[model samples]
Target: MSQFAENVSKRLCSLDVFRGMTMFLLIAEAAGFHEHFSTVTEGTVFSGIALQLHHHPWNGLRFWDLIQPFFMFIVGVAMPFSLRKRLAAGNQKKVTLHILRRCALLFCFGGLIALCL
Candidate 1:
């Protein structure tokens, strides 16, 4: 029942279980497990998941395409927590400055990564 405990609880937790689960599902789906299992059964947990795990044959979205969205969602979730912490620690005046700088940096980083492709 203290301010310190409240602050501690408000800390940004980057290791979210949902994020980890999404990453795991993405990696496993991208590993060709779906194709491997598709040859074996028509009905089963692994098979059904594998069947629904893929994009619609060749082009379109599914649970498979949601992996990137999940990552973006986690980033969005972290932002509020991160900003709250920074602002709470008497960094209010610079919060906007820092967020803008970081967003610009992230944009440039994305561009650089895209250029590599």
Candidate 2:
């Protein structure tokens, strides 16, 4: 494969892995794993771990709170590589417009989902 293609592929693979890990943590929390641990092992090390897995009560941040930001960071890291690859392939205008539209759609949908939740 071409060098550009290989680099893009590697970058995308790493991004996918990061996203997958983030999603897994989210799903595990949604499944009440942390809550269960906290309830079953209160006043112990497991309780402390469970607390870290959960969000802060209010007006603060926890490790769990970093998940969304980490996902965004991973996306930001991948964006330049993706855009460069597309532009290198000679679809400059089309790729830029498509990226803009995709980002806008994601923003809107994400806001809507947040509101619904």
Candidate 3:
């Protein structure tokens, strides 16, 4: 293997790839790919697959609904690796502040979205 490939394999590269794929799906959905595809493919064999791109209405889960939780799972999984690297750098103060700032921003944005909804 190449040196770059060897170095990447030593880390959680698969997790990064999974995170990228998850983000790509989210971006595609945001760009209306799912809605447009579903409309165009309606009443065909592909319709069933397209249906999975939308959330189920009140009774159960759908594949689309899982994308968010899967993303969150990826973040949770990656956090420890991040913390380990930061801690190894010996800057606990900066690390703690960064974590706090991230949490605060997430909370603010989440609240704003809920309010908008």
Candidate 4:
């Protein structure tokens, strides 16, 4: 392997797939796909799958319930790889500044969104 290839670690494709799947499911939920889909698929063979898309009632776990935790897991797994990549490309100070800037922007945007809602 080349020096650069050795320096930069391989990305986890499975994690990317999970992240994409989670985002797609979230977007579908936001667009009201799940409600319509469940209604349309009711009493059919796909009803069970459609129901799995919805959250479980209190005191139970469901596929939808895992989405948030899986998203967090993906982030947790990716962060160290991201930091390592940045550090390999530059120095600790630059990576730390980048992380700080990202956090600040995310917080500001989150607050703005909350205000809008």
Top of the candidates by TM-score = 4
What range of 10 consecutive residues in model 1 has the weakest lDDT sum?
6-15
Error at 68, model 4, angstroms: 1.7
Q: lDDT for each of the candidates?
A: 0.75, 0.83, 0.88, 0.90
**Candidate 1 lDDT, tens digit per residue, 9-106?**
54444547787788777777678766776766567666766666766765655667777788888888887777777888866669988878988999
lDDT, residue 22, candidate 3: 91
Tell me the number of clashing residue pairs for each predicted model. Answer: 0, 0, 0, 0
Candidate 2 residues 1-117, lDDT tens each? 587786663456767888899998988889987788789989876776777787877656778889989988987898798778888887778997988899899999999999999
Q: Flag the better candidate by TM-score, 1 or 2.
A: 2
* Model 4 lDDT per residue over 39-71, tens place: 999999999889889976765777899998987
Q: After aligning candidate 4 to the native by TM-score, how far in Å is the CA of 78 from where it should be? A: 0.3
Cα miss at 53, model 3 (Å)? 0.3
| lDDT (C-alpha) at residue 77 in model 3 | 92
lDDT of 3 by residue, 23-103 (tens): 888888899999999999999999988988876685577788899799889988988988999898878999999889999
State in Å the error of residue 14, model 4: 0.9
Q: What is the Å distance of residue 73 in model 1 from its true position? A: 2.7
Task: Give Cα distance to truth, residue 10, candidate 4, Å.
Answer: 2.5
Q: Could you tell me the lDDT of residue 18 within candidate 4?
A: 87
